[model samples]
Target: MKVWFALILCWQLLAPAFANEAVPLADDPVVEQRLITIAEELRCLVCQNESLAGSRAELANDLRREVRSLITAGKSDAEIKEFLVSRYGDFVLYKPPVKPSTWLLWFGPLLLLLGAVWLLIRTIRQTQNNANTEVLDDTKRARAQALLQNTDLPK
Candidate 1:
């Protein structure tokens, strides 16, 4: 039993040494730097809120590799970006240009916020108007006064 335990411990200790580790994206520092710069301007399609430079998703890694290869092939930043846009649409860009098709994407949240504010204001005004218009009859008012007088109020 002790020998079996020792063997398990040895295996666990050596497991990491035998495991394959992730290598750098590129051998050239300049290429890697350019890749990072371009990646920061691109969005990770899988993780919508994250930049490609920060995402660890498989698709993000694949895109990074693709971008690195483009850089190695002597493509300028603009050309690489244009290529990606042609393939993936403007959605891949962190800030898509303002165009008729993308107006809703940029302005939808503002429109929704304005609508909510308008609704809230209308609701509050309606409630105030309803309260102001309400009238209690003399009889009901007298009954309420009598009930209040008869009840032992809390100190």
Candidate 2:
């Protein structure tokens, strides 16, 4: 128990050494604010599902640094975005413009949903029609009656 207590004390003493330092804030708060705003509107190229502002990837950090430099250089938000887009293409933007090339991306899910709904309706109608047109011939009806009347059958 004494050895355990000594180890625990040592662990507590060394815990601060293992801790990570806080990230230094940008010199200009306005530039940081603009970086966040623009980054949130942009997708992280390395993490396709994550926004640039939310991603912790190395590429995300580098992109943030690049954006900060652009802000320092007095480029407008639009110009900064245009520059990134020119380098990385429309995939960098969270909301890419609807153009001829992006028509499939914009409308694919909606088209698939409509097609599925139409198929479901058609299948249901076909099933209903099949059920309605099913004939109960004498032999089949007698067999059904016999099954129904069998006392040995479970309820």
Candidate 3:
């Protein structure tokens, strides 16, 4: 029983160490650096908010492998990026080119914010106009006074 317990404790301690091994890749420092740079600029499709370098999703892993392969093939960084863009569309790029195709993606939020501001201004102006229009004329003022006086009388 003591031997079994010792084995279990030893396994538990070493399990996490095994799990932490980095994925094997090419040993060329320049190629590795290029891969890292490209990966940082690419968005992880499966994890929309994370860069490919930061995501652990299967798709991210696959993309990292693809980048490593391209680097090993001696592709220029621009060529690698073009290949990824062709395959995955502009969404794959963290800072996509400002072009006709991506105009909405880049400017839609600003347009919506401006529209909201316009609507708020219009609403406030309309409310102010309505409040100003509710001012009582002399006849309506006398009528309101009479009504108040009548309401005060015993029913």
Q: Write the per-residue lDDT of candidate 3 for residues 1-155, one digit (tens) a residue.
A: 99999999999999998774567766898887888888999999999999998898888888899899988998999999999999999999999999999999899999999999999999999999999889897877877887888854322
Best by lDDT: 1
In model 3, the clashing pairs are: none
| C-alpha TM-scores of all predictions | 0.78, 0.78, 0.75
- lDDT per residue for candidate 2 within 1-155, as digits (tens), equals 99999999999999999985654558999989999999999999999999999998889888998999999999999999999999999999999999998999999999999999999999999999999999998877777887889734333
Task: Report the C-alpha displacement of residue 80, candidate 2, in angstroms.
Answer: 0.7
Could you tell me which 10 consecutive residues in candidate 2 have the lowest summed lDDT?
146-155
- Candidate lDDT (C-alpha), each: 0.93, 0.92, 0.90
Give per-residue CA lDDT, model 1, range 1-155, as digits (tens): 99999999999999999975684669999999999999999999999899999998889989999999999999999999999999999999999999998999999999999999999999999999999998888877777777889864333
Pick by TM-score: 2 or 3, better one: 2
Off by over 4 Å in 1: 1-20, 143-155
Q: Candidate 3 — worst ten consecutive residues by lDDT sum?
A: 146-155
When 1 and 2 are scored with lDDT, the better candidate is 1
